[model samples]
Target: MTSGAITFGVKLPNLSPLASRDSILTTGTVAERLGFTAVWASDHVVFTPTTEHDHPDRRFPVGFDTPAVDPLVALAAVAGATERVELGTSVLVLANRNPVVVAKAWASLDLLAPGRVLAGIGTGWQENEFHALGAGDRFRRRGSATVEFIDILRTCWSDPSDGFTGEFCSFGPIHFAPRPAAGIPILLAGRSDRGLRRVASHGDGFHGTNLNPAAAGEAIARIEKYAAACGRATASRRYTTLCELDLRDRPVGPDEDHGGIHLVGTPEQVAERIRAFDAAGISHLALRVRALSGSTRKEISNRLSVRAGVEQLERFEAEVTPLIA
Candidate 1:
């Protein structure tokens, strides 16, 4: 948990339909070669197009027709392809799957990759997804469920001898082997008070999204306060953010405003923004290129070619990493 140097991670292009397994592997390999610290995959079990619901964050819309690669599977692919970069889930909805199954899968993954796996979890916002996964009953209590799930995961990973009994999840003492070599670090994702509180209590770090440097700094302070209240040491708590990257030399529109949450503008500008985040106590910054303007999944996929994605990553590595490192 020692800290000082800022680390950077790139989100694998798993959201676009055009992103094939080969493309995902290529992005991860390129990131590791370029000196990135980690590569992240996002999660979504299912997207029902027929459902009429606006996303909680109106800025980013989720199209049901858009294909999303399974986070765990995608990360496994990246783990096999790259030997250095940490494999991460940007925000895996923990409540969607059984904690026991998740613990086993992650434990095996940790063994396979040794200390290069990061479990970034979240209490998902999609009610439909929960219902689709047969976890509708647990959806109402997701906040508590997430906390309990983490507890279960830790017990299963660190001490199988001690069985777990909780409101949502209970399991008898069972043999779980091949535990993580260094123990996987759990990073909670979200900007809500409850989410931050969970990070303070149960998480080893905070994974924030849609936040500017100033906001991330403030959030870190809040997490420290909550951690202190919970009688937990906050000295080594990791703070990371997922920011939209605009590699264009000039601002395109209101979306690319200098003061906005996204990291937009020239490579130098982006590097300065990374420095600001570092000053804010953010240890890691996960960047994703902004999606092109497209109403349909096909249109968006057409805009986000594997070549374009790789080029953007290369640009950041060459122009921004040097300034930050």
Candidate 2:
């Protein structure tokens, strides 16, 4: 990653070859053309039953009725459409899928995208989705399982001499072909204090705290403390955290507020806050352009339309990218 400007990426809502697919691809490509650093997709095996207001903390802006696209597939399509932009999952829940399968898919993506793949992974939150996929048992100890799963992936990618033996994932002497030409950057996401500790100990980096910047700063400190303790000072360079941005409606101002959760306001305010995060030690900020998890008023909803999505990309490029550059 370049050292000067911390990277900015947007999450594209791609559920299928739906009516919105072409628009998202075109809009995402436009974002690349306008100078956004990367594009990301969310992961969900299946939508769990819930009302928009059911889980008060849930943030899918369009609500449960909207389609949930496979992040890998959506990213692959986005990769085809754009050039010079990194692609990633805001987070792919590893508990629901075989880690080996994910390893292969992400590795292959790296092959095609070359140096432009970021592996953002999480343990998962929806137990019913796992049950629907016959992977419910994997959730019993997801925290532990996620660690082992990532270890297995590393083993498969790294030299076979670097082996692994864990309770959930164990393997020996398997040749996985076409190792990613450039190693994929793996980012781990979780909110627990223990989860932060785990990231410090075993992960390549840390991920988002949803909308909590204070907690993210604290988590960064925790990671640094543990990194220093474990003789992993070199690994400290890999820390990345996500920043939630809600730009639905507001004038640009440094004093702009997001209810203390996200960077709300115009592009400059968002970028300035992002710079603050960079100063605090965040390497990446995953931008969610649409309200993928909440409700919006009619006009704000209109701004989230495909056309306005392109405008936001342009605004960020013009107002935000230069500050970091």
Which has the greatest TM-score?
Answer: 1
Per-residue alpha-carbon lDDT of model 1 for 1-325, expressed as tens digits?
1124788888887865655788788888988888888988888888666444545334442455667888788888888887888988988999878998999889988877889999999999878889999999988889999998999889889887868889988878899887886789999987889878999999999999878889999999999999999999634777888887757676456544535577777877777778888899999988776542111222233355667777877788777777766
Q: Top model by lDDT, which number?
A: 1
Task: Give the poorly placed runs of model 2, Cα more than 4 Å off.
Answer: 1-4, 15-19, 50-56, 160-165, 244-256, 291-303, 322-325
In order, what lDDT does every prediction score? 0.79, 0.69
Stretches of model 1 off by over 4 angstroms after superposition:
1-4, 50-57, 251-255, 291-302
TM-score of each: 0.91, 0.85
TM-score of 2: 0.85
Tens-digit lDDT track of model 2 for 295-319: 2222244234566556666666666
Q: Model 2, residue 24: displacement in angstroms?
A: 3.2
